[model samples]
Target: MQPILSLDGVAKSYGGVKALTSGALDLYCGQVTALLGENGAGKSTLVKIITGIVHADGGTITLDGKPVVIESAEHARSLGISAIFQEPVVFDALTVAENIFITGRPLKGRSVDWPTMMRRSREILAELDPSIDPAMVLGRLSVAQRHLVQIARALSNDARIVIMDEPTAALSHREAEELFAITRRLRDEGRAILFISHKFEEVFALCDRYAVFRDGAGVGQGTLQGMSSERLITLMVGRPVDQVFPKQVVAIGEEVLRVEALGRCLEYENVSFDVRRGEILGVYGLIGAGRSEVMHALFGTAPAETGRIVLNGETVSIRSAQQAIAHGIGLVPEDRQRQGAHLRLAIGDNITLPSLGRTTRGGFLSARREREQAAPLAEQLGVKMSGLRQRVEDLSGGNQQKVVIAKWLATAPRVLILDEPTKGIDVGAKAQVHRLMGELAAKGVAIIMVSSELPEVLGMADRIMVMRRGLVQGIVPRSEATPERIVKMATDA
Candidate 1:
């Protein structure tokens, strides 16, 4: 069967660097195609080209057996192409109906037809999710609901080729299931869909076909039937990933930090745990379980209303992040893009931002000192970059995460907190991050890892702390921890 949309030898370059050397993809009506790749594999570039965010330097795009050039985002929309990002782009101040028709509203004799617009919005939303109110303010809706509104917009535009770019990245498991339902509905309606994700489970569960990109080129594409994840990994990185979680054995030493009875109103309560030298204490829980909230409190970003922190056997009050850093603590937050890295800053600058005191002479910043400090950390973390002068925004997701870790490492904190450290990265990058955690633990840096992936926590953590509904269920040692036991502890009352 012929594909509804097909691209041959699509390529894009930037200032002498090729972002996409040879991109290829096919989206068929009534099917979901999984775009699989490691970071920097040109998937983003290909998506941009298709969506008209960037024009390809070399390639042929065919729609319904005819060649075409997608000139801009508006043009792409007009051509029945629409993309829904992880974070739905909608105006918070606008009503759901207003946002649905923001691009083009119904008009009766020059003036806007409010009743017609509202009716159309309700009709579109009813198809996706009838519970959503067309008259409700967009900001008042949950993340999942906002995504539904975005889909409604796509439907309103009569989009036939829809691209979902990590749509479940910010969603809960239940919400993701709901999205999968919506996706199937779209496919059944004879619309072609492209699903871009880092999750193998999600890909295998929802996609009917597969396409893999590596090193800026499309290396493989085939049906998902009879395809093992191992084969897919091999195709993505050009080699077998023997171990995605390379956890190394390290000696557990004296306790370095402890929290007792930590509590925050409506967030978390009575959370208590301790991390020792050369120990990896993994915190596991479902979404909204308060795992991150406790970490935020410990890091002083969100101080607990009721609790006492003991650092090296001494009680201390950490009311701010600076205080936490001064107390020899560092936290790599879950949302790296918004909370961890300075996107516009140079790599060297971001690395040394937390330790500017050491990189300054006579209250003045020293670029040489900053470079001297950042270079080794970047190299140690194996951050792939042209130079220290390169902006953090230009690096891949994996490299950007490494930069965040390196930034915290520069502080030389006795205790390190990593929240979803490997989230959204591919198998290759996940392994690297795990390896780094092992190395850090071996060097006697007390580590606390907060992760949602069960295998990752079980593989790397020396001890696991389970949280449920803002409360600690239990803390199980690695030897005693099993998937069933942990899941029960997290979900069971």
Candidate 2:
């Protein structure tokens, strides 16, 4: 079969930063091509080039064997190519139906066909999954909902080629399955799908053929029929990654953090749980099942009105995040880009921001002390960067997550609360983080991990607490926890 799209000697750069160098790739009709890479490995940059968000400096782009220069995103769209970004691009002012048909609404003669658009949007969403609300404002929808709208927008254009970047990063297991079904439907209809993801399992399950990217260039490409997950990981990282999960055994100590009858207005209620000194307590729930809110309540970001927080056998009232930190508690929030790190700041600056005062003497910063503290943590986290002076925005998604954890590690807290720490990170970096968590637990630091991924909770937790609709449905030991049991507790009011 002829290639639907092809790139020859493609290159892109941002000022002095070379994102892609001498790269080549191809997309064929009615097939799913998985693009694998580490954070900052230039995956996003390459997608931008294909979508005409950024023009490539040197390359030949051909559609259907004819050379073409896509001057802008509009030009790319005109040629029946569309890209769904890592972050869902939705206009908050528009409704879900409007956002889905934003480019060009279905028309009836001279007037806009509102009924047709709404009906068509509903049909598209039903094809994906029928739970979405068409009349709801885009601003009011969840991350998952916005992602569906973005996909619907691409389908509305009748695009022959579609590029999805980290499409399942924000989805739950069930939602991800639904998305895979939709992708297969698109493929069966002869649409070419370029799928980018960090999860090798998803890639292997969905892609007909896949390619690995390392240091801004394609490393390997082949059919997935006989490919092992191990081989793909080796190609992406240039080393053996035999195990994806890195759960370490540790002795559980006495409870170091405890909550009794925790309630936060209408957000969550009666959420009681505890984490021991040398154990990880995993909190599992659907998005908005009060997982993130529970973390906020514990950290004093969203104060609990009717709960007793006993830390190390003493009742403590945490009214603010500062008070929580002072009481030997540190929280790595869910949204890293917004709450965890300062994107414009240097990596070193972000790493030390939580404990700057501790490293200072006589009201002056100790630069030497700061570097000494950050360097080892960065190394341990395996952050691929030139130096600590590099801007956080320049780092990959995995590296940025490491910086967030490093910042909290600098605080030297007794109890660490990590909310979705490995959300967007790759398989290798995720293992490193899990290893670090084990090491910290062995050192007597209590850990509370809130995650939506079922496998993550099942693999790393010493005890699992399942929540459903603002209430604790059940708590089980890791040995007894299964996806079925957790899902039951998470949805069984």
Candidate 3:
């Protein structure tokens, strides 16, 4: 069967650096192709080329068995191509109907046909999700509903080739399932879909074919049938990942942090756990299970309404972040882009932000002292960058995560709370993070890691704490923990 869209030897270069050396892909009608790659592996470049955001320097793009040069976004849209990003790019101030027809609205005799526009929006939204009202304001809808509106817009434009880039990154499990259902519907409707994601589970569940890219070149492509995740990882990184977890056994020491009967109204309650020196305590739970809420409470970002926090065998009251920091506690939040790091700030500045007191002299901040303090942390975390002056926004997802970790490490905290530390990073980055966690544990830093991935929790934690609906289900040692047991404990009513 011939592909509806195909690329051969696609190449792009910025100045002297090559972004894509020999990119290639094929999108067939009635199928979802998974675009798998590590961060900065030319996946974004390929998407931009296809969407006409940037023209490829070298390559042959074929559509309908004929070579084509997509000149602009308008031209790509005209050719039935549309892209839905992780964050829906729509005006929240506009109504659902207005957003659906923002680019082109119905007009009757030079006057905008409001009734016709509303009717068409209703028809499109009804096909995707009948529960969504066309007259509702876009801002009032949930993130998942906004995504449905984006899909409605694509259908309104008669898009035949749709690209979904990390569409489920910000969604809950149920929301992701809903998106998957819509994806299958689009495929059944004879649309060629390109799905780009870091999640292997989603790839296996929703995609029929796979394409792997590494170092700006296509390394592998074939049907997803009979393909193991290990094989796919090897293809993406160009080597066998013998130890994806790489958890190191460190000498467990005395208890460093303890919580007794921690509770917060409408969030979490009666959460109690203790982390020993040089121990990794993995917190596992489903979404809204209050795993992150407990972490936030411990970090004093949101103080627990009822509980006792014991640090080094001494009960302490931590009602603010400053008090938590003073008590030698640190937290790496789940949403790194929003809460963990300063995106627009320089890497050195962000790292030193938590430890500004040490970087100041004579009641003034010193750049020399700041670099002296942050440079070593960045290097220790293996943060790849042009220079210390470079902004954190310019780094890849993996490197940005490292920067966030570095920022917290600078605080010299005895207890570190990591909320979804490897949430959106690639396999290589995940291994690096696991290794760092091992190193930190070896240094006798008590760590509490909140993760949604079962394998990660099992691999990295010396002990696992399971939570369900703002309550502690059970705590199991690593030696006795199994996937089935953990899942049962987390999901059981």
Task: List candidate 2 segments past 4 Å from native.
Answer: 8-18, 21-24, 55-62, 65-71, 94-149, 170-182, 200-206, 226-228, 361-369, 385-390, 482-493
RMSD of each: 2.3, 3.9, 1.4
Q: List the residue pairs that clash in candidate 1.
A: none
Instruction: State in Å the error of residue 357, model 2.
Output: 3.0
Please give, for residues 1-493, the per-residue lDDT of candidate 3 as tens digits. Answer: 9999999899999999899999999999999999999887999999999999999999899999999999998899989999999989999998999999887788999988999999999899878889988999899999999899989989988999999999998898789999999999999999999999988889999999999999999998989999998899999987676667889989999999999999999999998989999999999998999999899888888999998999999999998899999999999999999999999999999999988899998889999999899999999888999989999999999999999999999999999999999988988888889999999999999999999988899989999999999999999999999999999999883
Query: Lowest-scoring 10 consecutive residues by lDDT in candidate 2?
Result: 237-246
**lDDT, candidate 1, 1-493, per-residue tens:** 9999999899999998899999999999999999999888899999999999999999899999899999999999999999999889999999999999888899999999999999999889888889888999899999999999889989989999999999999898789999999999999999999999988879988999999999899999979999998899899988765667778888899999989999999999998889999999999999999999999898899999998999999999999999999999999999998999999999999999999999999999999999899999999988999999999999888899999999999999899999999998877888889999999999999999999888889989999999999999999999999999999998893
Clashes of 3: 0
Q: Is candidate 1 or candidate 3 better by TM-score?
A: 3
Q: What's the true lDDT of residue 163 in model 3?
A: 97
Q: Please give, for residues 1-493, the per-residue lDDT of candidate 2 as tens digits.
A: 8889988778988899899986678899999999887766678888888888899999899999999998889889889999887679899988999999888888999988999999999988887758888888889887777887888999888899999988887777677787788889999999999999877668878999987778788787767899987788788777776455667788888989889999989899988988888999999998778889988888898899898999999999998999988898999998999999999999988999878886688989888888989998999888888999999999877789999999988888899999998988877777888888989999999999998878788888999998877989888999999888888888773
Lowest summed lDDT window (length 10), candidate 3: 237-246
Q: What's the true lDDT of residue 6 in model 1?
A: 93
Where does candidate 2 clash, by residue pair?
none
Ranking by TM-score: 3, 1, 2
